[model samples]
Target: MSGITENTKTSGEPSKENPSPNSSDTPDDEKKDDRMFECNICLDTAKDAVVSMCGHLFCWPCLHQWLETRPNRQVCPVCKASISKEKVVPLYGRGSTKQEDPREKVPPRPAGQRTEPEPGSAFPGFGFADNGFHMSFGIGAFPFGFFTSTFNFGEARPTPAARGTQQHMEEQFLSKIFLWMAILFVAWLLLA
Candidate 1:
């Protein structure tokens, strides 16, 4: 990656445009290099540069401010591609020195994320092999056993959601529907 200058003029700061360098004086390679690293948002050399997943360059500060200005819709300034602060990849140029303290209010550019590789098992065993002993006690009497198992006697169950919440209302509605269905099933069984 090409080096970006840290002390370069920010978009917010005043700057004078240099007269176009004579084609004969400046090499074609140098001219291309200068324009290549410019931030899409600030239209200047990128400082604390980051590249969007869509491959557009930006100064982290400029991009952060742009995102802040329009919180609802965040997209690439160049391509209008979907973007977010967390998803942008920071560029670390060679010989770039870290500043001791940040002078600007904008937070530091996001770091690259790394994840560990999944472990490989030599032999995949049946899932139940490691669970050890299993035991169950059942009352042989038909009516009592059905009640005990169906009601999950002495087993912990999740408490209902708070009364006024949408989740609670949905649960109550579903419960009533299931209760009616069960009653209809019992009635059908007796008639048949």
Candidate 2:
């Protein structure tokens, strides 16, 4: 890629009004080499470069800002292909320093994800036992069992408490509460 100093004036400010004399004078091969690494968004040499699945290149910071601009609609800035933070691949070129950490910037590019291979089928000896001795219980008698336990069906019901006792009054209050609750539930069911 073309170095930043190649386009800068002696004062260090980038030349906007006049094209750099050396830029046109440079060989076409060098220009093509420079363009290959230039970010599609900023149109400059890509720093912290990343490539979209659509094969477009961009600076990580520029691409991140583009994604932030329309979070609901993440697309490639160049090809408009479906793109996301996880899908972009970071470009690590030769001479890039390993000591320089990418996360120093906000919202670092996602690291490449690797998946483990699928496990093979179970072993032959690991199969279920072959004794042919299996025992199973059925719920076909569940309703009868539940009623027998709860209401003691076919047996005598408990006798009621004598009138005016505290236990009798509490039982009466509970019965009234239950009756009102059942009535309200039935009314709700019908209305609904």
Which sections of candidate 1 miss by over 4 Å? 1-26, 99-105, 108-192
After TM-score superposition, what is the CA distance of residue 65 in candidate 1 from its true location, in Å? Answer: 0.7
The global Cα lDDT (0 to 1) of model 1 is 0.61
Alpha-carbon RMSD, candidate 2: 19.4
Worst 10 residues of 1 by lDDT: 1-10
Model 2 residue 141 distance off true place after TM-score fit, in angstroms: 49
TM-score of 2: 0.43
Tens-digit lDDT string for candidate 2 (1-192): 345434321122223433543555558756764676688889998887777777787788898899999987999877789998877777665557773534336475457767765434333222223222112222235456434433322322334577789977877787777667756765775699
User: By lDDT, who's the top model here?
Assistant: 2
TM-score of every model versus the real structure: 0.41, 0.43
lDDT of 2: 0.61
lDDT of 1 by residue, 80-131 (tens): 9999887786765554687432213376644766666543443223222333
